[model samples]
Target: MIEIVARNGSPEAMLCPAFICDACRKQVMEAGNVIYAVRYPDQSERETSPLFVAHKGACDMAVQQWLAANYPVADGWSDLWDEIDDFLAYLGGNFKRSFAEDADGQYVPHVVVMPATSPKLP
Candidate 1:
């Protein structure tokens, strides 16, 4: 069944998939392109854990970029770039916080990059 996740603050996904690391998850076998995913901290989880909520705009940009690039209508993907830039702009204009080291002292918002892997075992 398809699960529709609304508002990343729900309790259903506490650990919140660590998908936010600015990395691509899948690679195109034919063209060497990529598929990407992002993650944000689930508010419920953050209540007990040290995770931070991912900016919703980051998630939206990732989705739009994928749709624009992969869908049948490939020519219109330029807007995705604009959207990404817009997000960055918003950050620059609105927030003044910066990323800090985590408990293990590793850079956080740690980009958890998973290289494209083989097909799933069936």
Candidate 2:
């Protein structure tokens, strides 16, 4: 299973931590940009999961391609990819709407973890 999350700090903070994109190696400075926290099947928990943060465009595409090349397709890889795409679309829409409603409002960091499947027996 793969999990994706979008994160940003609260608007009330004096300073927000920088989230650097794993793909592009650049800072993720916008709330509207898509961020992902991928947890593979082998990962037992979200904390231990290898996070793959990237922007919604070219960087994200590169991450997907890399995932496809490294992981097996039969393990629901496509489903995870689709989920990420959907999440990105949702975030984009929400950001636009939020911006229109309150351009000055600061976005808080939030995490959305995907449902985990049954653990593999040793």
Per-prediction tally of clashes: 1, 1
RMSD of candidate 1 to the truth, in angstroms, is: 17.5
Candidate 1 lDDT over residue span 15-75, tens digit each: 3222231223221121211223333344222111111112234433454443333332332
lDDT of 1 at 55: 24
| Candidate 2 Cα errors over 4 Å, as ranges | 1-16, 31-49, 76-122
Give the 10-residue window scoring lowest on summed lDDT in candidate 1: 45-54
Model 2, 33-99: lDDT tens digits are 3333343444442212234556667776766555444443565343143334555677678877864
TM-score of each: 0.21, 0.37
Model number with the top lDDT: 2
lDDT of 2: 0.47
> For model 1, what is the alpha-carbon lDDT of residue 15?
37
